[model samples]
Target: MSRHQRLLALLVPAILLWPPLREAAEASMFRHMLVVFPALLAAGWFVAGALNARAQAAFARWNGMGLPGLLYVTVVLTIWMIPNALDLATVNWDVDVAKTASLFSAGMVLALSLRQASPVLQTFFVGNWVTMTIFVGVLFQALPTRLCNAYLVGDQVRTGIGMIVLAAAVGSVWAYGIWRRWRASAVVDDGTGVQSS
Candidate 1:
């Protein structure tokens, strides 16, 4: 890995683990879910860049077209997105540690496996994630009471809004990327057998 990636890989988890920063992130349900969890995943993504060829090969043998890795990510993210999980993570150090570790590992797996997946598989996984995210966001907003014991109803509503926006943004970006790739590959042929870009 490059110096910057290595530094970030180490720095992000350290910062998240630090009492003050950790406390700050956990202070709000919005920040804990949107900020802290993503950061842990990103740290793991950075760690993936450091993997040796042999290690990557080994991971590939088990991950197969990225299906397993994406499934793991989906499951981990799904579990953590629950309000109960949020409450437990905020109050229980053990659960919080497990959350961090699982998210980080999920990130590494995503980074390693995504490039190996076909575009169709990528779409299936990403679309499923987006759909579920929006579903959770809607549920969060629709519920009048607080689902998480550690957070207020207002916090839950705001988190729901954030989740919706995040899902839309990610979906848009992925769709745009696919559109661009499609445009790049499109070809036109004239009746004379001439091709134009």
Candidate 2:
């Protein structure tokens, strides 16, 4: 396999395992959503890719919009995540951390979707996705029964589920980036080969 494929293989398992581990500390409902969300997002992307050439073209255009688009997404996500972080202080520490991470991940998706679509934005999305994955893994490792105990205060399940959704969002972006890179490389190879011949 190529380096990119290898990287993708590593990333896929990490993203897939994140929510179930984290959800162990929360409710079953949350766990369900975590699994469902990524599946749904993947399905959506597949449908769009198959049915809407315009959307694919739009993503390409957005990706090429350069610095202005990146700046816009960064600023917007930062502004959105700040209040969510502040809200964290009012909740239980663990709950707050999970929620805050979800908020950040969601903000990234929204920001990137609104801006010019690009593979780079996909990279940012994947970074946030990996972060949530790590957070879930850590929570499970640190507090396994915490998820099972219904008596625990705060919205652990909801937050966990949100992270899963966020991961799916990130996965969609990552897939887009991979597709874009492959297309670009193919074009370059074709042009160079034609010129040399």
Candidate 3:
């Protein structure tokens, strides 16, 4: 990363963790999940770039094929997606800290694992995550009452819509990349009589 990029990465988690900003993010379920959680994860990803070679090697050794890291991320995401988990995090300082820490770790692990993971593994994990997101979004919208005690019915509905849109966008991009790669591979170089990856 460039110097400026590294500085910005360092600032992100710090700014997000600041008392006022943290409170603002947590005050609404929409911001809490969609904004704060993602921000923390992103912050972790950025921070991972700064890790020393030894640390990276260790992580790679422990997270063979990225499966373990991906699984950890999935588990953390699943937990925080629960309505009870959200409510507890909002009301309890302990849960809130756990939420922040785990999400951040998940981001770092995701960055490292994704680099090591094969295309098939990446697709499996990402596809499952996207599908789960859509399912949760639909549940949020279809429920008559608010799922999270910390958020209102309207907020829940809005968040649901946002989640669905986000999932669709991610899925679309992933699919497009896959399609482009496949299309490229299908082309044969006449001179070499070989396929391009």
Candidate 4:
């Protein structure tokens, strides 16, 4: 990537962390669960690429990241997915700060690990993410009461709906990518009495 692109990646996340954007993101359940979280990670991905190049190189050299790295990513994502955890991150300044740092780090971890992961493992990560997206979407939409103290019942429901929409979009893209890969690899016979790929 060009330095400019890397700079844009790093800056966008940091810019989002500004109080106005941050507050807006956490203004509702939907924003918090979807927008802010993704923005934070986007920043990390950018920053890690620009800043963690050394660390990633070292880690990559050290036998390549295996299951443990994936496990760490799973744990980080799962913790942030909980409604109560989201509330804590928003309401508590200390936690919010920690979350900012950790979430960014989580993004870094994903970037680093993704580069080294097996195709099957990459599929597993995407599968887990889609499952979580659907689960949270369903829970938010179906629950009669508010699960988050920071947001209202309506906000929760809207967030759920948004999550479901996002899940669909992400799932479609992932499936398309998989289909493309498969088609590229599959052997096909052409007409003319000769085998051709």
Top lDDT model: 1
User: Per-candidate RMSD vs. true structure?
Assistant: 2.5, 12.3, 2.1, 3.4
TM-score, prediction 4: 0.84
Candidate 1 lDDT over 80-100, as tens digits, reads 998888889888888888888
- TM, every model: 0.91, 0.34, 0.91, 0.84
Instruction: Give Cα-based local distance difference scores for all models.
Output: 0.88, 0.45, 0.87, 0.77
lDDT of 4 by residue, 57-94 (tens): 78777526445666677888888879888898888767
TM-score of 3: 0.91
Alpha carbon lDDT at 81, candidate 3: 93
| Ranking of candidates on lDDT, top first | 1, 3, 4, 2
Error of 1 at 19 (Å): 2.6
lDDT comparison, 1 vs 4, better candidate: 1
- State the lDDT of candidate 2 residue by residue for 1-197, as single tens digits: 34344234333323433655434532443443344334333333233324245764665566564344444434434442232442332334564344434433333334435345455654664565457564663454355354434323234445554665565666777677688878877876786566321
Candidate 4 differs from the real structure by a C-alpha RMSD in angstroms, to one decimal, of: 3.4
For model 2, give the 10-residue run with minimal summed lDDT: 40-49
Query: Which residue pairs in candidate 1 collide?
Result: none
- Pick the winner on TM-score between candidates 2 and 3: 3
